[model samples]
Target chain A: MTTPGRTTAEHTAADTLEGGPRRGRVRPGGRRGVPLPLLVPALAGLAFLLLPLIALLVRAPWRDLPEQLTGGEVWQALRLSLLCATAATALSLVVGVPLAWLLARTEFPGRGLVRALVTLPLVLPPVVGGVALLLALGRNGVVGQWLDSWFGITLPFTTAGVVLAETFVAMPFLVISVEGTLRAADPRYEEAAQTLGASRFTAFRRVTLPLIAPGVAAGSVLAWARALGEFGATITFAGNFPGRTQTMPLAVYLALQNDPAAAIALSLVLLAVSIAVLAGLRDRWMTAS
Target chain B: MTRSARRTRRTLQVAGAGAAALLALSACSSSGSDSGSADSGSSASSASSSPELSGTVTVFAAASLKESFTTLGKEFEKDHPGTEVTFNFGGSDTLAASITSGAPADVFAAASAKTMKIVTDAGDASGTPATFVRNQLEIATLPGNPDKIASLKDLTKSGLKVVLCDKTVPCGAAAQTALEASGLKLTPVSYEQDVKSALTKVELKEADAAVVYRTDVQAAGDKVEGVDFPESAEAVNDYPIALLKDAPNADAAQAFITLVKSAEGQKVLAEAGFMKP
Candidate 1:
């Protein structure tokens, strides 16, 4: 009887393994009965999230959309937004990944405090962050005064300021996500590589980095999205100038004051671009996990 | 068994606290409505005589009128013991948009007739808006005018680092008009979203000068020195105030408007650098 029970268990385990590849095709909540309390609220939550997007589509001025989009100003703002967001993401990755590794793989006094401080931008209002950036980097600011006198580098009302503001707001998301992933990843592999006559840096680059590539990709995507949608800091720190510091969000806001239709058109464009990029990236990296 | 009993007691405590909160919320709302109705009824009965003003009067005014309007709001509250005067100050266009979109405001005071027209066009105003004050453009420079910016044409000087309000706002539009009238083209380093922000850029010394309203320059005090140019006379902005058609506190709103137009209100506005309309 014990032999027969063990055989049945092995057969069921094999069946689950066979079914693993097809799991993504299966519809959730279809096989088992979902409790009504959860089902109702779950559906309601979906509707609540989708209603605003649906309204935008419903109220869209389809006839004038072509003319609205063909405007040079719209394209300029869109190009600037994409360029700034991508640049900000690159900047975040260059510094944020190392910071994440430091937090996860190393030990130090006040590590807990440092970790909390790294996430400060996540809670601070973006406008306040802008003000703080101004005080730190504006032409007459504390550090900025020295920079102006010595190097003649003024950041406000410049394209570079837009990237700096976006990075300031977006880097925290990348750091937090990467740190969580680093914590969850097995450190034994890194140790094993170090044991095989490899330097610590070599172990990190050859062994640890490849293991955390997916997490880094996910964090990059999160940071990119946050940077793309940044408005308050960009407007406050960089100020708005067409073909210069004015990104799509700033254009949409200024347009809203005068022309609601044009604002809606700009919003739809931003929405479409963000959705396409997110969907494309999700299919590439998210599906692998 | 004790653990289960404790869990039940905690759940009961949460529910009891929730019920108390709901009761308190309902009581507060009920008293608010009771006072509103009582005030309205008393005013209606005394309509032939001096109607007593009570309840809250919510005024949506332009950003430029903030200093003077705030002073008048306090004086209104002081005169009427049972009344409260609240002001929502922002860009005239933004305020008009809010009022047109059915913001529960008693009065709408805009920085320009153009913005007031938006409310009037929507039939949101009960009557024709009256021009209360006028504002003219001034060049706000760093204290002592170190840049020596004397005229509108001087702003066109290269490396001057001038800031202007965006053309969408009243101050920006006025600035644009002044620039056009003078036939001088000036490219500012930044086009700020509002009058206050334009003034702030100069005050912070980020920009050498900014074209903002006289009232804003005055409000900045010693931080910025105001430079009056002849072209400002070509683009003076007329501030318009009106009572909304759907005013909840109609009596109180009327009284507030009266206070703003009164001699005392004019004195306060003049002190704030606003010209009589």
Candidate 2:
């Protein structure tokens, strides 16, 4: 599930670009240059994607928005969502970089199968993932029983469980992104460092680390977004409890059942946070890379 | 991309499409059954003189009505010969919301009067909804009642983990009413999203007990033990059914509703542990 200290190609892009001066001239194809066939569907797809969000805004109870967003339960769910998503992103970084490296840089038996399994969570329903987690890590779970008997720890229905569930669903994005960057990167730089008498660990730390930092950063952002929106697994594994395992998505769902206005308010907050994070990261990342 | 990378990417794309197609295919097949009965109306009027109801009837029902309603759907199909019944079972609140949002459902069956009111208030129901069944709460414990949870108050004991549905749903609201009527301020380990999830917690033995509908516990078989409590009498959730305003098959939909309220339908509901309305 985890590997550590792996570097990828996007890090080198970050490093080389950071040191070099900006030299590109502005080039614009312009919107009118787009052909009709592509333009039509592209605009339609944009509308398709944005229409529901636009409806959410249009139908949102703007009058009650202030009260709904300021509610204690709303804040509690928001805070917990941010906290767990960040933690899950951090955990994914710590483990996923290495797994990505193994997949990208190494030749092993069943490597294809291993890569498929690593990204299986991306395709599996989060509810099924939660059920699998319960069978593996719940109190009565196979390994969870041992954890309970020895460590007296129960993961389900706890804040930690929310983090674990998010990580399970979100880590694949990190791994896939980093591995793509790693495969694209030239391994000759690491070889060059090794020839200069640097150990494999030292080579990775010095040369590969700086080279793949951008991929790591981008992967982390992708994972954070995925984690932030996580619903099914978190609700299934951690259960919904305000100020505990009830994250923003769960709160939005339960709220939709009763107070739809509150649900819309919560959804808007989540949307705003996602937009803010992406906007903040794009400046630093697009410039660095 | 390298040859292997491109190949792997192709595999991922195919697998993703396969997964998506599987879901789409399942949805299509269920609705596809409707068209199969379109040409089967030859000599169909001779059997019961029930006004040769044909075509498909889409019924949006509460999750609690799954078993009994499914049985009724099959029986209705058998009686009508050329008629098909497709069911969309989910939380009554969600089903009501969908119907109000213009989902083309023939009939709507809700687990509670409150949820039924949502549809009725939206002017989606063609006529007055008739109450069909009532569901009472039961404390679902581990098999053999290992927690010894005898009453609503007993669930509050320390070291006991209990799960209940969230207050937004009917079961949860009933549980809240039952708890309050018993004068108990019990805090459960978690408030699950639905009755089935609450029952699942007890079934998995993660929680010592759960307050769920009696029918749910009965449906779960021997996985969990049901403990009847007197306070449950105060919070009986009434099930209601009505034909939709924009029903595609109004005749078939109304006939299906009649069958559900019939003696045979009542018997099926009773066998599933539902009480008389």
The residue pairs that clash in candidate 1, if any, are none
Tens-digit lDDT track of model 2 for A1-289 = 1124545444433434454332352211222234334554577789999999999999989998898887899889889999999999999999999899889878999999999999999999999999888888999999999999999999999999999999999999999999988877889999999999999889878988789888888888999999999999998888988899999999999988877888999999999988998999989785688
- lDDT (CA) per prediction: 0.88, 0.87
lDDT of 1 by residue, B210-244 (tens): 99999999999999999999999999999999999
| DockQ by candidate, in order | 0.32, 0.32
Alpha-carbon deviation at A162 in model 2, angstroms: 0.3
**Weakest 10 consecutive residues, lDDT, candidate 1 chain A?**
A26-35
Best model number under lDDT: 1
lDDT of 1 at A42: 77
What would the per-residue lDDT of candidate 1 be over residues A1-289, giving only the tens digit for each residue?
1245467546534545454323344322322334334555578789999999999999888999999999999999999999999999999999999999999999999999999999999999998888888889999999999989999999999999999999999999999999999999999999999999899999989988889988999999999999999998888889889999999998988887777888899999999999999999999997787
Docking level of model 2: acceptable
For candidate 2, write residues B1-277 as lDDT tens digits.
Answer: 3633754665576557667878898889876755534323332442247567887889999898888889999999999887899999998888888999999898999999999999999999998999999999998999999767888989999988888899999999999999888789988878899888888878777888999999999999999999999999999999999999988777788889999998999999999999999
